[model samples]
Target: MILENNDFKLDVTSEIGRLRVLLIHSPDSGLGKVVPSKAQDWLFEDIVHLDTMRTGEYDYYVKLLMYFLDPDKIKGKLADIDNPESKRAFFKPDNETFHNSGKVVEIQTLLSDILQQKDIRKKLVAAVCAIEGCTYRLQLQLIDIEPVELAKIFISGSLNDEQMIFAPIPNMIFSRDIGIAINNHMLLNKPAKKARARETLLVKYIFFNHPLFEGYRDNILEIPDTVQHFLRPGEEQEGKTTLEGGDVMMVSPQHLLIGCSERTSVSGANEAIKLLFANNVVEKVTVVKIPHKRDYMHIDTVFTQVKRNVWVLLRSLTIAEPAQDESEPIAWFADKKNKDRPEIVQFRRGKKPKTFGTLEALLDNISQKDLQSTEPTRFIYSGNDEFPFDAREQWTDSCNLLALKEGVVLGYDRNDKTVGAFQKSGFEIIKVQDLLQKFETGELNPQEMTDTLILMPSAELSRARGGFHCMSMPLMRDKVH
Candidate 1:
């Protein structure tokens, strides 16, 4: 059973259960602004062409999702304000000054609403005015002029003659990292990077003002307003905590796993775990410690549950043993070339002391009741134990799969070895094109499908260093039997 929220039921207890609702953001104009020199700073491996992303594989991916999900549930980040209802709700034009009631009026209306809130209005004004180029006079003048016209000045970010108040958030398409949906409650996350801070703000604005989430304010997780905005990749600075949705996984109603990786810190996980335990929402919390590298930025980058009792994993992380008894309990990397025993290194705190015990000890505390049978907990390695194939495929997120239901999964077709591994595990592999054709010809039924892998084209999407699991943020799922 899925408990209904105000509009949709925000219930997700297991990863491989049937997906009922999802939140997806297609690539926007902001993506085109990212340049090669600043790609790494923006957390992108390489700059992707806006045209390719918009019209290529990603377009089909969103279309395929729409075929099964209700159209209303597949919300777009850029709301069309041209509609009469939207215009009325978002803007009220002033005939005396600005007559163009389309983009300018809509933005002004939102700004006006912000200015009306006495509690936050002054703070916002002070914050923007405190900047070097943003003068109080300029902000005051902005109230009258249309904001959409000044959008290029903000996006270009050259503050020479203009106030560089905003920058393009190119990574907003990976909506999974903006917020996390646990059980029936939603936690709007504070991003660990400055580049993504605005994405969190957009999500907050939606949940606070959007009609879909109107009555569920209490259900949304709350954090202090004074919290730090950004933390260095692996820096353990005090007084700040950061968490991302990509590092969170709901194993069951009672057991939740949070990975302290490059993008999520232990301090952040501790704060969340305390609240979860206090509310009696999660009985046990396992904090998995992973390598702090771009390749393994999040746990889902190397591990995901693809079907009932089945997990796709990078063997290097899960099965590898530490090099010595004195080293850390978890061995993250393996030498694919040698194809020998696991290699490990001793664990050391980055810059701050850990308030909690060793990760090994924390994970050992997982209740025995949640452990699965030996036969059922089988893992399919990314490349089926092959050499260079395993190393190359793992780098491209071969393990990151999104499950629509038990025994039905979605993956990238470029990873042939990984796809073969799934086929060897009794899953019938079918390309997205073939699957759609079957649906159109009345030969395939998604509801009755079992042990199937629906492969999606990934030539361009893989460049973003994410897969289906990273792109979607599921709000509701039918409970598994």
Candidate 2:
């Protein structure tokens, strides 16, 4: 775990620290597989045109990342870094010559392992060959092809008319939900939805076998694969064990925040809490139970840290009349009332849920003390004292902002109210294009900026219901001051 100046480090201790490295997946042809008939089943709210997302939505996101970090430091799908020059730039240099790097060789060897394993190879080929339009003989012959090409086929996605043999992971663009980095270690999560299961598998392969991650060990939260859920009885109910990176966050080195939402189950949060405590990684854990509805699928969907002590949250979660919702608790901490069998407070559907006072309980759990100063941690609601605006903006992921550094964040430009709220707090709201232009012209430097919020294009990305935080998975970040 010793970090050399040139060696890549995998650690993230805060949300708003200066970003050092990132992992992302740009949109691919798999998005085209999402037909209107089954868009919901595929985890997509609506069918999106692959070309539009690739050229407009995804391309702009990649450009923004390249601006903050060296292109070589950003990791993504093999298709995006297919060329020799890109490969050389992306992989670690072997010697004086960059072309001799270990990336291709290591990845190929990893693919070779898949080909070498009889059961795995058969399972993979059988799945692909099963596609309605695929010829079993022709597809089976693909095994004889080179390892690199085979890997490409696997990643690029294979499909036929009726159904996708290997559905291109369109959702991979949201890397934040696939894997999470804690301190110097990696936590590989098992995605709840079948559509995103392939994403977890792909990311796991890269981290476990790729040369760049060869020396690292990952603590994986394993669950049933997509196929297993349907094939095995009671497997569908086991989804309670699912955990996603979107529902997990690092509040500080000593504290961890896990959300039990539509995407992350209470069982999953419990498992993560157990693991974090067992590893002594964190001293305390907070399990926030958000509404199970899709609009509030993940905690980040309705809440995000904007600065060191400031948070942007949905107004619906926190109340104006502070009597405490004793009927609907939105957050939970370890119940001290139960010592023999410690449990989180009762809240959620099916069973009658109870609510707790938001301000007092949240402050107590977060600060672990009675605080006199309220300005220490400010909470900004998504919309102004407006009803429809709050519901409307929250649907577009207005609260899901990603902090580049303390006081500087990134979010969707379309959320005028949310952006205005940050601006009202003395944040300099700058458009992504404006900043990109400045970076290109050498007119602005991110290292010197403070209290800024860079707005990104959201015409298409917002349609996907994600913002900067959902799009990014920080591999490393400078410790916040």
TM-score of each: 0.73, 0.76
Candidate 1 residue pairs in backbone clash: none
**How does each model score on lDDT?**
0.63, 0.63
- Judged by TM-score, which candidate is best? 2
Q: How many Å off is the CA of 106 in candidate 1? A: 18
TM-score of 1: 0.73
After superposition, candidate 1 runs with Cα above 4 Å error: 1-7, 71-165, 223-239, 320-375
User: How big is the positional error of residue 197 in model 2, measured in Å on the Cα after superposition?
Assistant: 2.1
Query: How well is each residue in 1-481 modelled by candidate 1, as lDDT tens digits?
Result: 1112344666888787787677766664556767788887787887787667655566556545644554232223113422434422221222222222211112222333344444444444344445324667766654443333332222233233244455566776677888777888787776778777655654665556544455667778854423454534445354357888888888677777788888887778777876776666666666777777776788888778865467787766644443344465633443432243222222222223222333322222322234342344556888886766776788888988888877787888899999889889888999887775565455766678898888888877888889888888887788866
- lDDT of model number 2: 0.63
